[model samples]
Target: MVAMWSYSAGYNVVEVGDDVWDLIEERTLVLFNHQSTSDVPLIMAAFNSRPNLSNNIMWIMDHVFKLTNFGIVSWAHGDFFIHGGKQHREASLLELGSHLQKFYIPRKRKWLVLFPEGGFLKNRKASSQSYAKKNNLPVLENVALPRVGALKVIVDNAAAEQHTDDSDKIKYLLDVTIAYPGGRPLDLPTIFGGWRPACDTIFHYRRYNIEEIPKDEETLTKWLYDRYEEKEAILQEYYDTGIFPDAHTTHDPKFEPVETNRLTGQRVVHDTLEFILRHIFYIVSTWIWMSFLYWVFTSICQLVW
Candidate 1:
């Protein structure tokens, strides 16, 4: 994976807005839109080169990553395991979450990446309304599926540690939506092709600020619903204006909403199923490769004896 992206004919991936970077300096939480596989790596590579940013960046890697050829790629960088599931029982995996949070936690709050969209996608967008609704329940969201495990953990942990409504600690959040100009969407092929030369692949990131958080659940729900509606409008302006998306749309409540990729049961099911299959293959391939190496080593030892 690194080889592919590293060898790309022309590296067009660039960070447009400094809102996220600026906010992080003041201790803020950022919920970014996940569009392609390159999202995390691109973010890591983008910030890794920055000498001034001190926040320790970490990402939750699924269990199957241990099996992939690129599994080590993630680990060597800032890869982490999603809380619970296959990795939860593994003591080392469970320990990593706490360890990383502390490791990355500088003198102040850390600059972390949370993929609230869960996994990379083409057109799917889950609003803040949906997230708050799910938070009302004790069960939380799907287990194996990626929702906002990292975010939930951050909130819960903060509340537990501070023994206060740490929710208030989250003074700001940037809702980053990655959109492609020229009416195109990102896909696996183009993601892989991201390593190659491409003129039409520019992705525009739109940032929105969560200006307020309701004190109660009911107000929070309404706030989230209104927030996503606001997000939809900002996306349209991106098409209308060539100027990069920023935190300018919040002041206008009357902005028109754009048609969205409606949420569906089929899309949810597909994402979960695909994530499972990817991990299964990862584990199986990892086991096979490990076994092969073990056999080769034993065979050589016996020959020498």
Candidate 2:
């Protein structure tokens, strides 16, 4: 499905390095950088493009999965990674396999996909640095890539747990950057520019992992975060030089403080009105929906009888 969209939409994907996929094929735990929401499907298309990587991508999704129809659709059929409840902190190898097998794991290879940043981050450079520091991983301060905590989880799991004899438990970070030819690189605002609804179909695969940091579980968590602080310093230096631009660095000057009249009195009146309306609307909507459903079900029962 994603491949077909990519083919139709004319989105071009550039592979930053070939070794990235090589690590992938070798059953490495893969961590990808988060840009726009477009990241996921694009990666799916890229994975499909490779003959050897048909069904090895797994992702950890969040709670919006229940509230929206989009969530239902994305994971309805495909093989991906996910965790819920206290299970996430204590997911056993057997439990991981149970979810993993839903997507069809091979007889011996252990492959996984993850986004470590938790969710979309507005300040990628700073957030990535902080997360890296906390996890004892090196930070790519110049550019916001994958967060280290998620990678730590994968590493710790892989290191402590055993897989098949043929399975090699290695870790990798795939840093993907989205770009447009002759156009600006995609960012948070631009991707959702037109009040566009859910990104059902879009083709975009910008950056594949260029750098690889290999570490064992015991030391990886601490080592990864230390890298973030180092990355922050490097980024600060890069910003000073104007050499390569550090992403998410504020450069505009129009941002200035503005003063507003004190609104405590007016705010009190408005809040009172808003409170009344909020309850009225909530009760009204709930009653209407429930009443309509009840009538419909009653009519259906009568017709059946």
Candidate 3:
């Protein structure tokens, strides 16, 4: 459904690295900047583009999202929901940590996507800027200050837990920067309206090994702050120059276009078959719903007459 939505919306995704998919195959934590609800479909499209990366993904989202249709689907996917209210914030974090410890096995291949900023950049920008001013931190333009508590808990637990083998012990962290150059922010309404961007959506991926990150909470918090600061700089550069710094570019030789089936032999054919199956499923579902409604209407009319 996500792939079909993305394709129908005319979302052209340009990924920086091929190795990022390999990292995902390993137990990897993916951190991305939150822009809009459309980010979910775009990210799903990114994972779907690669054969190595499975769409079996989990997300860390706030309780408010659980009220939406997206939230219902996410719930089915086993996503962790955290309460954002001040009263239950600490308790929620603790619960989230415990859940992560139990849910994510070291040997399993999982992609845990985290929006460390906690909310959309546009909504949180003013508060983030005010906080930065007070703390002498750099004023973030593109992204907001990341709430590190959840990150700290996840990293600490992952580091402390013992894996089956030495290779499995080290998990990769991919800092993915998603950008829509010369385009408006994407939302559900925009997508439903079939609004296509003039330019392609660019996803910049940089990998960080788990062993490279500090395990201690305090240092790790600072590390996350530093990472966001770097993100801010990268975004600032993009806005000014209309291109990201070449130093951050991932020149993956194996990277191929979505239309190309060379990377995975039967990918294009498989995707076409999946698309057809999805349409059939939708058609059958609509027919069932309409038939039930019609039966109910006829039963009511017969009783009244």
Top-TM-score structure, candidate number: 3
For residue 258, give model 1's deviation from the true position in Å: 30
Clashing residue pairs, backbone N/CA/C < 3 A, model 1? 8-195, 61-80
What is the clash count for each candidate, in the order shown? Answer: 2, 16, 0
Candidate 1 weakest lDDT stretch, 10 residues: 261-270
Candidate 3 clashing pairs, residues 3+ apart or interchain: none
Candidate 1 TM-score to native: 0.53
TM-scores, in order shown? 0.53, 0.49, 0.81
Residues 1-305 of candidate 2: C-alpha lDDT, one tens digit per residue: 43344333444354332224445466555545454565665566566655456555445665555456656654663433344334563453344544444443434344466655555545466766775579764656334544344465454454334545435444334333333332223433333343333322212111222123435554554444444343345435544663323232111134321421211111001123434565688689989999999999999999999
Instruction: Rank all candidate structures by their TM-score, best first, as comma-separated numbers.
Output: 3, 1, 2
**Index of the highest-lDDT prediction:** 3
Sequence-dependent TM-score of model 3: 0.81
Each candidate's lDDT (Cα)? 0.46, 0.45, 0.71
Estimate the overall C-alpha local distance difference test score of candidate 2. Answer: 0.45
lDDT of 3: 0.71
